[model samples]
Target chain A: MSEEKRIKVLLAKLGVEVHWRGVITVAGMLRDAGMEVVYIGNAFPPEIIETAIQEGVDVIGVSTLGGNHLTLGGELLELAKQKGVKDSMVFVIGGVFPPYDIPKLKDVGFDGIFGPGATQEEIVGFIKDAVSKKLGK
Target chain B: MSEEKTTKQILQEAEEKRKAERVPLYNPEALKQIKEKFDQWYNTKLREEDRKNWFVTPQTILGSEIPRGLLYTPLDVADLDYMQDIGFSGDEPYTRGIHPNMYRGRLFTVRQLAGFGGPEDTNERIKFLLAHGATGINIVFDLPTIQMYDSDDPMARGQVGWCGVAMDTVKDWEILFDGIPIDKISVSLVTHYPTNTAILFAMYLVMAERRGIPWDKLIGTVQNDIIMEEVVRSGAEYLPPKWVFKNQCDNIEFIRKNVPRWNFITYNGYNLREAGTSGVTEMAVAFTNAIDTLKELTGRGHDVDWICERLAFFWDPSMDFFEEVCRLRAARRLWYKIMKHQFNAKSPRSMWMRCHVQTSGISLTREEPLNNIVRAAYEALAAVLGGAQSMHVDSYDEAYSVPTEAAALVSVRTQQIIQAETGVTEVVDPLGGSFYVEWLTNEIEGRILDEIDEMQRLGGIVKVIETGWIHKKIADYAYKEQRKIEEGIIKIAGLNYFRAADVKLPEIDVFRYPEGVEERQRKKLQKIREERDNKEVQARLDELTRAARRGEPIIEYCIECARAMCTEGEMFKALKEAWGTWRPPAYW
Candidate 1:
């Protein structure tokens, strides 16, 4: 009956993404909700997954506003699967995403899709609920 | 002749008259009596419970949180002196407006920011807008070009032409302006940072030069700013702050002497304000940056008047209509003072606070996306009343994606309606004499000056960026504002409130970005690499390397490299090898 996990999460911007105010705001929001959030500046997709594995985080949030979601985002999830942590971790994507891209992102193995206007409370609640059920709390 | 006094006596009389014009607007005794009467009116007529401690503000940014008064009077602006503080528009210390007739003299230039996909695609859009009556041109490059990566580089994968135009070589510039008039209209290149400006702006120059346009007749602006890279723009490789500042001054030096009609730099306060800084902080940081830049140029033995006249500013006109109007008036006055007292600038043009403004994209909401149209209209109106030399109204769909042609046309219509039908611009600074506007103008001016003083005390803009002090300030501001929005302390119209509306986004189409842009750009770069004279490119790169190492100006070498069809990435690598690279400090 112990549901006291800190809900560790890792966040990073895709390469050369300049509109990172969204990532900073989300990282702060998660940290405010008592989540252990590790934020690394813009990195390559493989390096980001490697850091997530090394840090043993429960979620990977990749933010990119540069309209590269189809290719780069697909590669991000493919790397997660190749590294054998695809099922263990909940992958999420955020930032300037069109609503139509939601289905495609889900197809690429993104467990959650947060675009513009997604509230902080909604995100923190979603991640909390997903992580707790995974922990069997 | 006998009635005329001696020259000494005439000089003393003129000085005395000038001192007389500096008198205060209201006497202390009169103001005190009015204050007592206002309190009496308030206690009897106003309800006690109706008076709340909190205030609703037009903008939630810093310098905007305060108590509001139910009434404003002459007593509120008792300290204002009309002749000394604010005067007629187009006069010295041009607080009211830069031109005496304001819009009667000329309407504000409608510079819509349009770029996304490959160079030819954006070029077609530019021609369409021009045929449709847009007065000015504003070009924003894509993430790869803005970050100084070639279209073929792995770092540029999938992002070549997403955010803006993909420009790799001088050939791309040629394609971009293939049919456009170069000398007739003014172009604003959103080239942020020294290295990017050094590369892309050089391409623009080479393109125009190859077309045989005389350099002296060219008219446009390049955003050769350092703070935009160091503090505002996030997540990219940057040249070190010291070296970045040096290159910015070097651009000013070259442009002032060569392309004399073009504005070399528009110190970017717009990006700062949109990045969660207060309106006052935005002006303060921009003025401070200008002060430091002018100093660097003067140290190189250029007079203040020579290079400072073509310098310009870019500001963000936020939702606080009166506050922003006052900020602009106060900014004009303060800049005049700085140029006069600090730099002893001789030319009046050097003292003019010429600025191009844009509506705040952050202030637009994602919920009920159409609500953004009304919001942007109000912000555009504010920019007009504030006397922005040129302005771009953000489209409603900007909160979601790049604007469709329909959305962009609506933005142009927004500006058109304001300029033609509203009749708002018939008068210059019509709100100049309002008690609240005058009082707030003086108050915001003082606060901006105080911020400038604080920055100067703390080792100026470069040192503060190195230490990440400014970064922490902005982050804290953004975080607090977000918390307010989440707590419902600051309610967005359809988002945090009015939840009953059907917030369906299908009402408008999210712009379908042209497909295969990245592929086309990659192929173009590959062709240029194969076809262009590689030996000539290498010779120019070597000269860039040698010039960068000796700490000599590199813009000349960059121009030569552009002449040889050298790619932006090739020249940037040479400079990076010499001047070094920087990673921003992690303030969070």
Candidate 2:
């Protein structure tokens, strides 16, 4: 109980979207960085929240490329609030999000927002620090 | 004469044997001299000098790990047959081009994939581009349409009109091409899957029929390939490869018989390549699919020549400049060989490898977006130099959304500038005789053949797909490429490397979907249900179900349903009931 546990990250792809290389690459990088990662594919907002609660994952990463960020990301946050998992988990969203959508997604309650051209070190480091803070490490 | 063998007689017999075996392009003695010279140069310049460790292994941008030599010369292509291999353009084994005078005869069609918001919005963009001198029309459907979900479906929420036109019924198809001179302006419907192609393309056909346009008079292409549905663009509920191929063949069978001028199927190497396979694997997969299509079509009692005459290819020309050029060249030559030698196809037109090229969108970066313009231009130039029949240049802003209007115009103008200003199209295959190109062309052909053999060994490409082997292979290559980029082995400007801080990136406008698109589309679907012959549509749906169960081509039934105002989802649902849905092997 006194020691830190390996950060459990759950990566969920929103909707039946294609062009998922970004998410898959992130998953691999996280796994290699000694994180327990469960990738649930083609999920909706409610399912993603339910899975996070069930899996008790420290971080919830939602990747979408279908330009449904504002709509679906907001829906995920709304559902996470109703499910009351908003504080227990860290949320990050990455995809083909434009520069303008960054502040909007941040306002939608995502802790981390990544657009295209995000590096492995940046994403990984951000997740590690966020998860550590969530665990009060 | 051989019994009393004079030296000349013996030499003549040896020459005859060599002729049967197809001797090298250069004399053996000459090649030996060239090899010695090459070795001498390599030794003196590198090994003998202080830069002894200067030899760096060369690889492609996509990293098939196909080694590249320092230089290619006549020695590399010593065995190439001039008359047999690099024949004149329009001849057998068309390494030069399908047409002798390529662009000089008919300039390549400049088409951009345009669709977003509603059908009317896309129609307006198509008109704008055409007014700006775009030669043809190409349209893409929104996620719901491509995924075969109606606008009102729960799974389709938040996605309607998000990226492409929100098409659901024949009404959308009708509105999409409202006044665009259908017969004259060749339209490419990116109906990316067999199931969707059957519905969307059927709606298109019905619309044309309503307008009194004969299907035979229309010219366009339908993306009716099986790989897109089963492999490249996979979903959990896609129909199994076994039945999906049937839907694909049915569409092609009907199209070849009815719309003879239209390309029935474009074996989409673009989607497959964009899924993150190497450039070489792209051709291997496409030609493999084409070979399977040829077999299935011929098995349906269609003549091989008739089936192949309108067959086409779609390629994603990435940043591998020379390899992209060589790949297209090798693909053309290999296709001709497969037609002539393997299938015994009779018509020369049937053997032609007509392809459309779109510069690789996966190669674009969101950071410092202007660099993408140069990347796209060079890729487009590769396609043009490689002799694509039609071309599309990816916009610099595509990493974000379906390109904005300004970006779309730039893409169209990119092709125009290539066609008008570059002067690269004046002659056919100017790189045809270059030592590097010819040597790489032959090398790529051999490697591609080896790859095809590998596919055959794995029980053919179709079995490979049905077994989920292709997905695994793609993932492996994709991961490898990602690692390469991450490790700085492959330098993507403004992304992995060259993060030039001093260069000011211009503020680019991103495309936004029109408001209430989903509401408007749903209203139209509701209105159609209220207005159309509902009983007739249900009856046609039953016909479609029976057609699917009876192993008949369902395109006819789909056309009937489209004419009856049935929606794409209705047809898709009917087929799902008849043929059943399938889940692919979970790689994650």
Candidate 3:
């Protein structure tokens, strides 16, 4: 029997989102929940996805409160595909996104979308499920 | 009793009776009976149903979930002395208020924080606000300007005009206040330290001089409160803490001698509250910061009365109604005692706590953004009842973006409606004699006093900041508050609880600066550089560096540089050459 792999996630802030409180809180919570979480503070979308690919992270979680999530989120997915890591890596977003943008976010191939009131448990559970499903577990 | 009682005994009995009468209308025995009946009802009738249907969370004030009594009576506040603690308004230890007839005589100054994009954009907003009856102008600067960077710096990309107006040179200031008169309008530069403020102050002086306004006639406030910035916000230490202090003291001392009408430093606790501190922490930190600054100034042979009299405060009035009100009242009383007892200040003006309040931006919600208007209204009402000297209402769309002009106007109207239509301004300290408010005031006062004492014991505010003690406290509270919200312990309507399904998301018109604002700002700086006398600019910068190195007051030198048409970045570079910049200790 193969042993279960610990889910490796990379969390980053996209495009000048200087509100670090949410990103810091989510990083700490995910780390305590037994996941290998790498936080790349704040960077451009392409730079963030490059770090995800380099770190071999199974999930890329982008945190933003700057209202540029739609444009940046779409660019991140496109960059991941160009880098040939789309099937291997799952994309997730968490921050202050309006309810109207949820369907659009999912349509852009995000595995999960966490808004303002998402709990740590919900995030951990979703990340675990998404990673395992991607690995064909 | 039959024997003749002594004269002292009669006086003591009268004093006791007066103390007992200061509490609620009910006597102690009656209050006890009411509490007993409430307990019985809570246990037998309310407890079972509360458990079955509704989860009873603790009623908290600013994240301290201590249980409060259902009602308070004379018993709760019998120890308070009316003469010493709860004196009349405009009297010694002014707990009720600093003015005799606060709102009835004059309403608080309605100042909206208006700034975004270029100088022309902010200038238009200021004119609009003034036309709508705004009494003061609170100017917000862009991140680059606040960080002491030029607009053309590579580090300032994408952030030049997004947060606030991008100001790089004296020309920007001239355009910022184009048609507005400096003497009539009270302007506050909501900028930070350690050198940005000095540069901004120099620009203001240069502008006034160009317009033939005297130094003493210029009226405004520059938020040179670098202590709170070090403690809570971006831990960006432009220079070492001691250097920052020296620069701030230079401004205070220079302004005291030259510009008597301008407030040199406004100790801001609003950032602390926004960073998730309790009311007690906010009050304690602000007081400690002010006390430390006064001590430094006095040690330098400046009069304690002069510094204390000119000092002002900026606070955040959150959604907790009574607690917010009590926080301001207790702050006034505590500042009065601090000035009189600790500093031995004799001027009554020195003892009065003059404060400006901004409604809490942390309380605004991104879910139903319109609900923020209601939140701001209640907070503004609390600030009014708490006796603020000036107030700024946060725009409803602040959660999503920098407020559009429409949203900013609505925010100003929110305060206007409360000031004109609502009858809250008819009386001074309208909730003064309420039992719960009095008890809360006493409680908050005691807690803040204890924290201030602890800070003193921990080697004053500056030392605590250098050691990261207070920063740790803020971080711990912030994490706890976030956890409580995630756990559903703290219920925010439309966010955590009572969330609506199938809600139509409101289409907010987020303010977007015109493209190439940063490029235009850079071009303006270049034009000033090419048009001015380079030799004079270089000479002024060299003098500024020498004065900084020799520990001389550099405000005059800064004004010289401003007069020579030097850029902010050039002044900052000159100072950096004299005293190298500082890097804050790694926090987390």
Candidate 4:
């Protein structure tokens, strides 16, 4: 758990939807995987991504089960770019996503996509790999 | 000796005669020998390989604390009394079922819960379902309507016409049921709370009156179970608990005299199950709420026999196939005992526990959405086996959003296939005599009774809810269930085990609400406001407010308000002004 190598991730939900079980479970898994995880609670506004930048998180994971993922998830990426933190933070989207929307999300610059039932190992590994790649480790 | 024995003595003799004629399925020595042989075989042959290739963890029966054995025998049900506990179907202590013929005589009502967008949108869906052979209609109100707000209110932004249909006034109700035969088909409105339920009931009466149907001919249920809503669902209480109880009793009293055929209240435990409480807790909490409501009513000089006859129960059938079946059976027996022995109900109909079941919404996974169709089929089968009087199947895409028309049809078809294709409905209580089911029914009944006793010790359901005890219990279970899933202790098919690769995911069309649904609903509400007589509406609202302040029954006044074309928001505002709103105590 060296400070230089430890990964920091921010977990949040988009819009006014209150489906928080997945994100909360993921936050626990990430913490157990030896990463610092900050969870902004359910139905948070997109501006919270700026808080991730202020805290210097290496990855931002947004979970939404509501069908507003297209609008809300896209708004999150747009907000991150506006805040100039889009390049610094790895963006991951998860929960209730249709596979056809994956390409559109990827085109919007989301680095990883984890739909429902994404295992803890895969999520932790994805964050670790993304952090290593970003840091050129 | 020739003199006629008392009825109780005669019944006791009949029960003893039946017991004496029954022979043991297995002798004690034979059972011991079988057990020893099984143990030897397990140790000598299958133990190591079984442990290696399979996860042979101790399996606890779902929703109960008891662990399951490899098999159950007559020994498991040795203590059950056929007459006192597992009576014949349509008899006293009706553990087998309420009806003598059960599904053999008639299939359970296939009530599809449908509503979304605006009134017209939901109306079309209703017509589509009826055309598709749906036997009943369960209307779902949007969040704003459930919260007693007008669609046009600023408080309803982004929420209007999203979750369910938005009905702000009688006009919306008229459009929602325009062509539907209100007198023929059973309609259930999924609305809780006092004011909102009262408004909807009043609107229904007015709608029927306009259609030239008598009040006595109306058949439906308004789910006015406020206690469940306060403890598990939204936890939004517009008035204090006392007023909630008062208003609920008002509806019951009014319906008991006027609308004798309608179910005034449908006590629900389905939401508690969705909130992650165990099956036993769901039953206990639901019945306790019913007992509390009955106490309030009888305390006000209403007869239990009359009120209990019109009450219905709602439950959830989760993936626990046998457990859910046993839970429903146990619920019927437990409720029978409560009504007949505790409350002194005179009629058998008053003791009957009629229930509606919905497949578990929380069990559906967004991953491998098609797999949900299988999950729903099994759950629907369980509900049928459990003897539900009506049932709703969850749509595969429900885990994502409000079900699309295609998904909703699939859900209805799931029930249809189970009813029409499968021969499961040919027998009355087909699983009734199974040793494991009988044993589990008694076990679940005991656990639920214990929970009820604990609730009574804590000063009843209302007290537990007021102190936030029940909410904390539900939250605790929710957390534990999540943790269990994460640790792989409880396996959800596509979720924990058999994980699919992302590339293998299927693409499906999800339902999207039409653009400008909110604006359209607002415009409709504005039009109603402009067209209706303001003076009469205000006068009716004033009368409602006065009735509330006077501590009198408000249902009749609410009817006046609805007839005057006062909107749901206006009626709720008057009541809220008269009786202050309640804020749920933070329990977590």
Candidate 5:
């Protein structure tokens, strides 16, 4: 079999109101795992991530801590669909999100959800596992 | 590094300039007098006379803690030079003051920070402040407008009209400036996170142009303090640093070409200070961030002279009187030294520290709220003595909510009292000759230089920020300060000390969001989308994307996107695709 493709992940803190610590940590972890990664800056909303995904990113991750997660996050997932990559690229949500909000977030079509107190290793392992399972490698 | 050039050369330069009066020794009599006063102040309430102790404690930022005190003495600053190190105002090493005649028979611009609900709401407040002795207006835009999102955007729901005024187009800006004179008053628009600031300024300019207002004659400062935005908010996640830096460069270039007289960014340490940082971190981080931006601007083919003059600083004045004074003095001196020694900035104005000071918003406590008036009064006086070019005193009741009209008026009166009642305006740099003041100045200057060196050793402020150095520092400092207050060690009057029994606080009146503010803003943005040439907006956004791909000036394209009603998030996303996100370091 051909060598397995190392999944590429780009992380961002989507929306205009949130800070970006969690997303950055996750991005660093992804990079350390030999995943080609791109980081969009903070306060970036959905459209930016969707556009970045058009560059052939295998997964798009967003971290948010502000109050507009439901609205901004929903819009981001919608933009992903609008950009025609809802299934092609996995989308993840992370930040001060509570564990209870994971179902709601997942229902909104976010591929994965990581909340407060999540370590970088956990996020990287999950992304790697999810991408690996999807690629059948 | 030679002793000869340090002492002899400095003395010769002083003698050549007819400034040599004596060996630069600390005057024994002055030191004694300063110590006597300091002892008296420290011992006034102490149980024992021997309890009087003086020491320089370093206060930390978000991540560190250093205790500071009320006074600093000549003993603390014995190694500092008056002529060579402190230097003359308007000269190299501007420690004493930035300009030769700082406070030049002119008061710091009394900018009233006012904006809320909508443009009309802001207009009324602007009129109110200007009528009440406010020499200028500092417009604070709401999160919706600041982030370049239309009020109707799902992301902007409920957030509309919460922080400040919401504006979506040229029409909104026109209404905001309705009767305000662009030429007469110095307007400073406070904005951070330019994902939308440049476009907003462009929209304001478009309206100004439509009104036949000369763009060159229109003066105002657009605060593009993007570096400290992450720290100001609730440490949430956002874009990567690379994109933030790119956007700042685009704004610098855009302002250079279109709004030549306008200040593109006012590297804001004050915002972080308001978010609760110590005086040293305030200056260190502000300067560090400014240097990062300056280096990038210069690297992007922008001349230091052209960009430096348009550059400005925004710092906060804390309650610590002497420390605050030293902060300003140290800031000026450090800016001068850095511009000359590091960047080779030759222009006098470029080296001068032209800053705007706002009384600490974070310091205004929600308890014993009226006491905030006292806090603001002292802070404003510190800014005046510190030779701030512009200042805004926080409303006494700002901690609870938006300042009531009475509270805002008291804020204005606080500044007026210092300007008119206090004999401080009669002489410039009134505390210039104080040995204690000079000592504190050197202490702060020394500490700031060390901080800059540390940041430089970390590769730069942007690198340190990426490494989460600044963020961690600020967080640690915040946590320590909170613990101190909680432990009753650093007693806050209302919170810790002076407990009162069922105290009924006075009802403070302030601005309220207008009824249906969200609906009105949403409709306004909708109208903008419907009326604006949809074809033009698309063409502009495409052009903006193309410019970003080419690493061209993205600001003009951003303005075009703004005109097209492309939300702030939309404009930023287009750029994000090209520049990629900022990957914060994993140190935090």
Candidate 6:
């Protein structure tokens, strides 16, 4: 990608749990950072997220608040792995989870896990670092 | 004089003839401008992934379940009879409003759903809320207790004391209510199964006995509506339909005989709507379950009036303002009609549709936390105008964890402001005569009736649920609503439209689970296991099992087991062995 080409990211939510506030914050930060952004919206199963990734998004984020976080999150990771985009696209997970559940989240291959108190700068920096690692700029 | 036409006569004739002198369209032309602006702003023509951003299309809309309109007009409700259907405030049906004096002097209960740690932590929250002008308390049991598992059960690991307070036995109850006077305040719990809540209620009675408090002085609600739970949860897959009805009947019979003052069942459509089903679906499913409960109780010789007196409802007020108000009005009118015309209920209370409402939890966005407070305020007002008896506003931070103290306090303050500052309550049924409200109310009622009839043909709400009818409908709507939002059809402020800058909200006071709650609770259960008259516990369990088998009133037997220190899970397991667990069909 050229320096003039801004990284475009799409954030979406899957399942009945509809917590999108974190994704919105990240989207605003990315836009401020001069990156192209799109928010796909809530309650799409893993297939839709895969579609966004397939659409050549630079990064993909998904949020959930319902009880089935374990099942849905794991499915997204497996889908990403199967699609061979697991390493190419950064995957982030956020919403309500106990502190101890973070290790299990890491084990599931989420690139970043933003728990309850994360800020916009922290999330934006993580995305920037991932892009830098890939681009080696 | 020609003839005395009943309300039914008038309504039917009006529907067929459409002969009323036209009132200029009930909603002013401003609504059209709002719609035009909304469409222009939304750009529904585009395709998007966010359900919140997508536009709702005619083809994508659920064939039978969609809410007809966002803003209903007088034409939508032209056929409704004000006197017969709505009636006066506090009168029969109380459709317009429950009381002529609603909110004139008193405010609806300002209860916040709070639980973290163990009994002690919850007790402290309760004390704080009571002192802060919360008229009642709504309990949120941790996942362990909700699933009826004791602290020591393997299924309870990690989940104990997570979401709400954990209770293993009567002693947990003792500590949870340590200094609070139960009889003086209204209490409601978000529990569904009867066996556990019945035993818990019996223990509460025992606590009151020890405190020298009379049972009649107790006022509150126990959410023992098993059918509603089944429909709202994974489609009541655990228990057989026969057993589900039997458990509900047993609990109702027991509550009526033992705890006369408390509401026996708090039926919930709130969970269903929050699950993303339409408002019409919520009303239809709720009423269908209510009818099923009535059939079971009355078939067993319980008087309709007696059962109706204790029956109650729980609803979720979503973000659709006018639609929600009409939904509430429609609920009251429909329930009253069912009681008067169908069940022949003579008592006014039997016909009254008393409800408790919580704002739609799904409406809270995780992105812009502060914006949720505004959404909650609107939902709360909708519930109030719709005549909710009690309400709990969902804390904006619920998407994260148990609300911080500041969030909960602000939630409470939202209600206080509405009660004290806003003159909304000054006039009872303030929105009653509004052409839009009345029309929307009638349309909502009409749609609900049609849906309920459709569900009845499938053998009732339980069968409809057993067949996975409700879940499919909710999933379908959830999908379409998402598509519309993602496609820029409907713009959620924070998500789709006029995106705001990333803003930091004031820090909320977090409530942590009490330390040692699970360990302490497990120890208590262990002590009861060692110290309780073991033989007596066995005896009571045997008796309860036998009573359940014999189709006898099982509440008393369950209470006896509670007295002997039998755990909630053990009692539930015993019944599960007899009735089996319900599981929803996974067509997805």
Q: Of the candidates shown, which would achieve the greatest DockQ relative to the real structure?
A: 1
Give the distance in Å from residue B86's predicted Cα in candidate 5 to where it truly belongs: 3.8
The DockQ-based CAPRI class assigned to model 5 is incorrect
Q: How do the residues B1-588 of candidate 1 rate in per-residue lDDT, one tens digit apiece?
A: 345342223324544667756778788898999999987976787777545522345435333553445567998787677877788888877889888899999999999997989999999999988988899989999988888889889899978888899999999999998888889888888998877888888889999999999888789999999888788887557789998889999988988899999999999999887777788889989988998898788888999999887989999987777788888998998888787666778998898899999888987776788888888898889878888899998999887788889899999999999999999989889888999888788788877878887777777789888999888888888888888877877667887777646666655688888989989988998888899889999999999999998988889899999999999889889988987888888888
Q: Report the CA-based lDDT of candidate 6 relative to the real structure.
A: 0.70
Q: Which 10 consecutive positions of candidate 4 chain B have the poorest summed lDDT?
A: B53-62
What overall lDDT, based on C-alpha atoms, would model 3 receive against the true structure?
0.78
* Interface DockQ per candidate: 0.70, 0.58, 0.20, 0.17, 0.08, 0.07
Model 6: CA > 4 A from native: A1-95, A98-137, B1-81, B234-237, B500-510
Clashing pairs counted in every model: 0, 0, 0, 0, 36, 31
Which has the higher lDDT value, candidate number 1 or candidate number 4? 1
Which is better, 3 or 4, measured by TM-score? 3
For candidate 3, the per-residue lDDT at B476 reads 65
| TM-score: model 5 vs. ground truth | 0.75
lDDT of each: 0.85, 0.83, 0.78, 0.78, 0.69, 0.70
Residue lDDT tens for model 3, A1-137: 24377778898876644455667678777887788888766566678878987898888998876554676788788788898887898788987664556788888778888865567888888887887788564
- lDDT for model 5 comes to 0.69
DockQ versus reference, model 6: 0.07
Best by lDDT: 1
lDDT (tens digit, per residue) of candidate 4 on A1-30: 354667888877664343445565677678
What is the per-residue lDDT of model 4 for residues B1-588, given as tens digits with 9 covering 90 to 100? 235232223334554666766555457777687678766865787767664543332322135545555566666776555676676899988998999989878889999998888998999999999999999999988766876778777546566776788888877889999999988999998876666788888988888888899999999998887665465544223477778777877888888899988998888888777766788998888887787788878888888997888899998888778888889899998888788656778989999999999998888887778989998899899888888999999999876678888999998899888888998888878898798899888888878888887787777777787787986787667656766766788777777676665435456778877677788988887888899899999999999999999988888988899899998889989998889887556544
The docking quality of candidate 1, as DockQ, is: 0.70
For residues B49-69, what per-residue lDDT tens digits would candidate 3 score against the true structure?
Answer: 564644332433254443456
C-alpha RMSD of candidate 5: 10.0
Q: Residue pairs in steric clash, candidate 1?
A: none
Give a tens-digit lDDT track for model 5, residues B1-588: 222132223323544665454345577777778778867866685545335433444432122234444445565665445677666666666766666776655677888888888888889889988888889889887766666566777657756675578877778888999999987787888767655666677777777877898888888888776665445553233566656667777788778777788888888887776545677777777777777778788887777888888888898887777677768887887777677655677788788888888887666665577888887888888888888888888887665456778878887788778877887876767787676787667667767767766676677665776677776775545545645554555655765677566544445554455667779977877777788787887778778778877867677776667556665555655766766655444433
